[model samples]
Target: MVTGVEMRQIDRYTIEEIGLTEELLMENAGQAFVNHIISLLDKKKARIAVLIGVGNNGGDGFVISRSLLEKGYHVDVWLVPPVSKVKGTARYHMDIYLKLGYQVNSFETISATGLSQIFMSYTHIIDALLGTGYNGPLRSPYREIIEEVNRSHGNILSVDIPSGLSADGNVDEPILAVKATHTITFQCPKLSSFLFPFREYLGELTIVDIGIPKRAIDQISSERFIWTEEDIIQTLPVRKPSSHKGSHGKGLIIAGSQAMTGAPILTAKACHRLGAGLVTLATPETAHQAIASQLIEATFHLCPSENGEIATLNLSNEVLDNRYDAIAVGPGLGRSTKGDFIDTLLTSFNKPLIIDADGLYYLKNFLPSLQMRKGVTVLTPHVGEFAYLMNEPIEKIEKNRFQFSKQFAEKYGVYLVLKGPYTIVTTPRGKQFINTTGNASLAKGGSGDVLTGMVLALIMQQRDVQSAISNAVFLHGKAADYLTRNGWSPISVIASDLVTIMPHVLEQYQYS
Candidate 1:
């Protein structure tokens, strides 16, 4: 989960301090890639074309070409640059590869059509033309070669990163990048592989350890991380045999309007499904009859209504006064002209509070109050909502999401879960986590509501509050991932389906 810059630092530290030579690391990287892709290689018919640049990535291609040649696989080393341009450690590897009696052909001599035909003849195209250092628009032979590689029918394997793709997660011209079928990145994943637009270029990403020591990686400071299954497994709260319904935690979900009763229903369903002990939904009295029979397991506290939306929060009410472990507001709760109750909830609720959907719309006006809250306030905002919250445009926030998310979380003293293709959970202290689970399947109405409920449940259950927040964000996406993998189409996966699929995913992890 290291960025391109952080990875370079680790590589430099490994070479200088850890005593691992550049040549050794390059060889290890090549071998690790070969080991991972060996099963895909067909010695009987495979014609491998290794597209080499003049960088460390090209050094990796030289090792890969030699390794494939020794393994009895037919490999052609195609040099994008002249022999004189290859220098330093990459040139050293090139000399070894040439000394082994394998001649390298320069692509500069080949026509565009000929290059495409040659690439089509190969079964696999090894893309080592560019690495993480590349950004902006492509130029000359590298751009032309990458374009041909993408047009080719061969399965492309990019070394470290797809050629022309930026490793720093900044996608300026993603169209110029090589579309790889499989990218065997060294050590850990590059930040760009997880981002949109650039992510489409990376087919199946595999992180191969290239002998960079854990100590070397640890010495490099990084705030960004990707949550894996192991992280979710370790963070999940356990239900003891002696525990009862009340032992887990109590959660209050104040959501829904007459027109959008399904929002709170979906939220409560997800909350209860995630093992919340006693779940309560407080909505306007007008909407109570609609959702009352829909959720029998949960209790309802009717609130004052104005135009079918909850108009006010009575502080003396038993439901609000209850020592609930967690309280979640705003899922289908309509826009509020008067956010006095929102201000009251912010000041009074001295526990973990999750605000989502219309709640965010209301909370945006009271941003200053969020800083004064005694309880941990979690705001889940999609790009549009976040734009409104920041009083900025969506385009501005999308360009630098990490910076904006961190800044907002730090400024407001609250956890910020910026939801999208890959949800980003940032703490008040600036620690950020990228949830690796989930996909485009989560792009639907009511999905945010379901996530809000899950966050409420996990926040109350897990002892480590931050881990609980991250777990909720990860699992919410995992449920969508599970549904899509198990016969449900991304288009057909409604928000309620996520609530239904979540139990199986949670139980699978819990029992396993």
Candidate 2:
């Protein structure tokens, strides 16, 4: 959750306020890095290369190189800077490494041809050339060295972060970055690992507890965070042994025009799979038979429509009298003329309302009343819909997603689930929960409908809006992650495929 600046602040506080020695932390990092390397690759006479910088990152490298040599493994230490440039604890470690007769080559003195030759001799390479402090364009030998490292056929292990990656995820575009096979970070997860372009550089992220006191981390007031498995597991709804279907939750879905009937079908099915006790489909009369055929378990309500689409978004009095636990509107409802109908429904519906797809399109006209609305409103908007709602350019919104999403959620008094990589889930009070699960697989159509249904189902079961919605987002992504982990290509997967496999994923969380 911490930015690069915040991470530096925490590090300083750990060393100064907590009185933890920097030398000890550096040793811990190198030792842990070496330990992980031994576990990952066979160490019986294995060869490894440690690429070092002039700073503490290189200090960690020197310790690692010496440790590997002591363990009887052939170790090659390549320092990018001259030996004179190495200062403090890094110089201290380099001195010991030289005294032990380990060769430390100056990367500045090597040619591109020499780098390629040296790189080929090692099967494993430790990228300790740069840590979180790296940003902007590559300079001098670091550039050519990284090129050779990438070109070489060796498994890469990055220390803290890949050499060219920024800890803040500030790259305007993807550039030359070390494509690490695994990155072992210290203390907590960094911002770069969770962000889009930078995330690609981090292959398999491993956060090691480098003994930074929890009190030091607590000083960081960064409210943003990526939800973990424990956070999701703790928020999952517990089913009681004695509870009946009626006690689980009741949900009503107002979606699916005759032409776009797949949206409501996906949403309703997702709701049932997500543990909705009772679900009723309130689609256009013309779309009822098709939706009903695929959804036999759900009851149906054929609402008034003209030309296979709903004429208005108003709810019928009979449906309102039934008092459903939750209601989600606007997934594939097609185009509809909005007047006072949305206002009437928002006031009268009087339950948890999840607006997605076409609903987001409709809600764009009523942004003023969103703050004054009586019921809880959850808006699941993609970049385009959110841009329409805010009347901002797509480019501008994407660049400042966190800031824009937080403002909209707080100003409108609604829970905004802006769907994207590490989807930002922000509450009206400015609590941000970044979802880390899922991938590009969920980018297909009908995915939002499934997520909307999951949120609606959870809201019906749980009273805490943040907990319900956050868990829904996490579970929705977990389903996609589950599919991808099982060899289903993200590109080949469909929304229905997510719904089909989601129950099995949910089953894993049952007894947790």
Candidate 3:
């Protein structure tokens, strides 16, 4: 996935370097979009409204309208701007469309009632009013047009991206963006398509090649990546026939307080469910009895407690030893006064360390320690926790999820998993892999805890740290998706339900 800016650069490189003309590229993009959406269109009954702006996006719409008319489909090309404003390649295509004996409807003087009547009358509305480069608040007729477009029940297909939505994934006024039933983007998927709130606006997204040179795409180092099913399939860990229980890996989970003991149980169970050969739980001795009964597979290291929360970790003992392959901390371990527990784990643990929940809360105090760590540190934080760590408001973090995540990951030399709708996993080197396997069903209190355990288990098992982290995240969401698809309601699927159904989800890839 490339950012909007990166996509524009590629467009320039394709035209100048590869010698593909702007008109030819627009023609190809239009054809590709038509081919993708043709099945959904009925030549006899489909009344199409191709909304056109005075940009390259409108140029593509002109081609799409001409192509649709040629195919015997009834189409009306509406110019959102005046005829005098349309220039360059967009105007060039408009001339051809008009020469084909097709009429263009100009929205220059159309009233609100007239606009709604036109939009509501159409069976499918193609949003070509704005392109990926368009950002910030919508202005004048565009804003007014979009508000009516949302009210229309017509199946909307946005070209490149929904009008008014920022391709950079920033939402200043998201409510003004067009609500498309489908978005056929050119070259590659835009970054905004994967983000929340905006994802709702862009429905059933498709990426069309538009004949852009592979070299042009390669010229820009698109740090953003998405892991497909094939990637997960190939990366799935294979257990050897002669392998014993120890062959998989051992994981240590330090979580839980007397008040919130279920977090550790959920974490340990998820760790074991994801195929951790040996699982150990380190928590307050007071909480052990509660966590132990629920998660029997894990061995316990009862830590000293102060008022139900773990006060400190006895690092001198074997609890933080070499026998464990990974350690996951901070699911339910509440606020600690000293903050040394997190510091000790960061410094003492030479192996991979996964921190989540309250662990992230404490780690906020030791942000600099992440850079100094000799071992790999993985931080899994939702927007709220991430905001806490960054000491910024949630609004700022939500708007610039990519920028903030990339900065933190690169600066600290740690793998960062910023969890939400489409979970983004970033490496220390600044490469980000956006996960698309899950749905809203995964939204729950313990979902993040389940993810922490999965990350802990997978990192120990998979040789490549990147694959391990991405796979765990993908699978964690996939499990929730599976449950919701079968019979479970989104609200009914709890954290433990995710752990329960994970085997069935993993088995598909494992045995396939």
Candidate 4:
């Protein structure tokens, strides 16, 4: 079930399918908008300017102006086109404002000096000029007004999306979008707001409750998702006091070579910290000492190798029969070990698997076997790794991350976590969860390895595939967010730091 906040995206359908008039939706949207502004400003003496266009967006501006006037605030309404050109709900609202002894002016009639005088007088600028319907490039008077607003230096607020930004995706050479201090977007956040490049245009976003019916949203299907803390808390695995270490589950991590033993060590440590009862690391025989010395909590399995890399080994029934909750491979595990150890593991293991880095590289070579696995599998691939697995160019993956992530999950019938600025979690069931925590400090090396460990740990703790992936991704990023706030640099936030902070981060969800 979605929260009432998520249902606001259905307002459009409520107007069209459910027989509710657009005018009523508009009034509710406008009143909600006014309420948010009042909560921010709260009786502070300030002059407000409302910049509106000709469509329903302008209609919302008109309603806001009427509501503000009723509240006894000094307000000026500037319509892009003449008042006569306004139509539908916009025209109706304009008529109401005119009858209420309020003045509405056209941009054309105001001279350059007059526009400057108007711009300098307002403390808060309301940009009701564009809504989600905007497509392609911005044009003419709207473009000029957007440029003026960009230069105004006044605090600006956008209605749905910042004007000039594409509602569906990023636009090349986008005209100056409104630099909103805060954006009161109706319903769901647009796809563009989650992507890079254009995400900067949307300021601190606030989704206002506009009374859109829930049935309308349930009828629609979308792969995009936004995850909240409650969502994570609900999915957490229940732990019993009677449970022992073996009952919780055992996870085997095959990672780290000679020069990169730290990667696997980080992954194993994170898994143990996240409550994986028994954690083991399979590494090149030469690196066993380093991993064993550092991570006393995890057992080490020495694997045969040449030059600090593990060679492909035959998987005996003895190895496969041993109970393991899950298996994770490929963080700093070199590509040239033997004739595909990753392929050997995939064909042999029938347990839950978490694949990252070199493991993802090996999977790219044998993607057909991805569907053949008899057990649950989660693939955590960064953009480049994802590109290799999908056989698509990196540029193409970056441009359409949401589509590619969803496609890969459905194609392989496994959970996929496409890690980046906003990590996207896609499940075989077609549900998508977008994680919003984490900052630039997570851009350092070994961070991905830490994330891999956390996911495997959750799986060992008996969390479902979706819950394991979602909660792990959220906490992994949130750990970095906490460290970043404490002034930890990207370079200084090593893998061990993430493990140290896990308990504090997990505590935040206990009450939920």
Please tell me which predicted candidate would have the highest lDDT against the true structure. 3
lDDT of 4 by residue, 1-512 (tens): 23223333466568778988888888888999999888666446777889999888899999999999899887888889877788998888788888988898789876666777778788888999987777676788887788778777677888877887777564665446787888887766777777777678788888887777657766663656687788788877766889888877888888888888789988988888788889878888887887788889888777888778887443464575495768899998887755376776667777888999888877877777878776788999999999988888997788788888878788788899999988999997668888999888788788999999999988777546777788899999899888888888876786678889988888888556
Tens-place lDDT digits, model 2, residues 48-164: 888999788889899889888898887788788888899998888888889988897777667788889999988889999987777779988788888898998888989888888
- What is the TM-score (0 to 1) of candidate 1? 0.97
Candidate 3 per-residue C-alpha lDDT over 366-391 given as tens digits, one digit per residue, 9 for 90 to 100: 87777899898999999999998888
- Using alpha carbons, what is the TM-score of model 4? 0.94
Winning model by TM-score: 1
CA deviation > 4 Å runs, candidate 3: 317-319
Order of quality (lDDT): 3, 1, 2, 4
- By summed lDDT, the worst window of 10 consecutive residues in model 1 runs over 314-323
* Model 2 pairs whose backbones collide: 330-359
Quantify all predictions' global Cα lDDT against the true fold.
Answer: 0.87, 0.83, 0.88, 0.81
Query: Candidate 3 deviates by what RMSD?
Result: 1.8
Clashing pairs in 1: none
lDDT of 1 by residue, 70-104 (tens): 99999998998899999989999999999999989
* Candidate 1 vs 2: which has more TM-score: 1
Show pairs that collide, candidate 4: none
Q: Between candidates 1 and 4, which one is better according to TM-score?
A: 1
Give me the displacement of residue 174 in model 2, in angstroms: 4.3
Q: Model 4, stretches more than 4 Å misplaced?
A: 1-9, 42-44, 111-117, 313-318, 487-492
